[model samples]
Target: MLKTAILVSAMGAGLMVATVASAADAALGQKTFETTCVACHGAKGVSVVPIYPNLAGQKEQYLVEQLKAFHDGTRVNPIMQPMAAALSDADIANVAAYLSSLKPE
Candidate 1:
């Protein structure tokens, strides 16, 4: 019985670690941003264009919510709607994580 308890505890801990690992990956986010967001948002989440918002150092939850809104058509924008539509939920989370990690200029 003690052995079974230990095994179950170990399995639970492994699952928790896996969950944490899968929650967000900033490196993956950077790759996606390079391919998708570099044009408007610049190299490090600072937008080159005056109209585009700077994403660096923004709150992660806010970024995630806005992106989801754009993806769902709740926050309509001609450019961002389509751009955000291409991202999955995981991609949004990762991107938000990456952007939030940056220091705003």
Candidate 2:
């Protein structure tokens, strides 16, 4: 009983942290998307190009990892490489939150 309660509490705390982080970064993400990402990714994460994957409905952690890779030049998208390299960790996280929340088309 005690263990279960502790586990539940920990999970709840983690969710709270994630929500707070997402909320704080959501606005910044919208701005970044308008300037940098929308050209390829499209508004609300729906991509017009078949080669460009839809980011909506992707796991948040997966999105974050991919963004980090792009920023570090580990992932090679011709147009994205330089832009990703310029993004801060907060930008990546916030953008992930905003995009991931969109419904996949």
Candidate 3:
């Protein structure tokens, strides 16, 4: 029983760490956007160009999926593919979180 209790505690701790590691940091996302995405996506995710889709207030999961697709070559866009190629999974999550958190204009 004592061993079982210890095992459960260890499992809980591990799960917590995993959750924290996977959680997106919106602050980091904003910085990345400013440096990498602001040119096309805009500061608050509203695109100034009619051709660029506005990202503000979009569903976080959808953004993540699309970004992943772009990164993986499943989605083809000459511009997006190259831009997304540099983003890691965590960066993608962060960017999605930041964009989704915005209120669209």
| Top-scoring candidate (TM-score) | 3
Model 3, 2-69: lDDT tens digits are 99999999999999856854599999999998999999987799999999989999988899999999
Q: Report lDDT per candidate.
A: 0.91, 0.81, 0.92
TM-score of 2: 0.73
Q: Judge candidate 2 against the unseen true structure and give its global Cα lDDT, from 0 to 1.
A: 0.81
Q: Which candidate number would show the highest lDDT if scored against the true structure?
A: 3
Q: Tell me the deviation in Å of residue 102 in model 2.
A: 0.9
Off by over 4 Å in 2: 1-24
Which residue pairs show backbone clashes in model 3? none
lDDT of 2 by residue, 1-105 (tens): 999999999999999977766564767777887788887887788889888778876777788889889889889888778888988888888888777777898
Note the clash tally of each candidate. 0, 0, 0
lDDT for each residue of candidate 1 in 15-105, tens digit (9 for 90 to 100) = 9856753589898989898999989998799988999989999988789899999999999999999999999988998998899999999
Model 1 weakest 10-residue run by lDDT: 16-25
Q: Model 3 — which ten-residue stretch has the worst lDDT?
A: 15-24
TM-score of each: 0.79, 0.73, 0.79
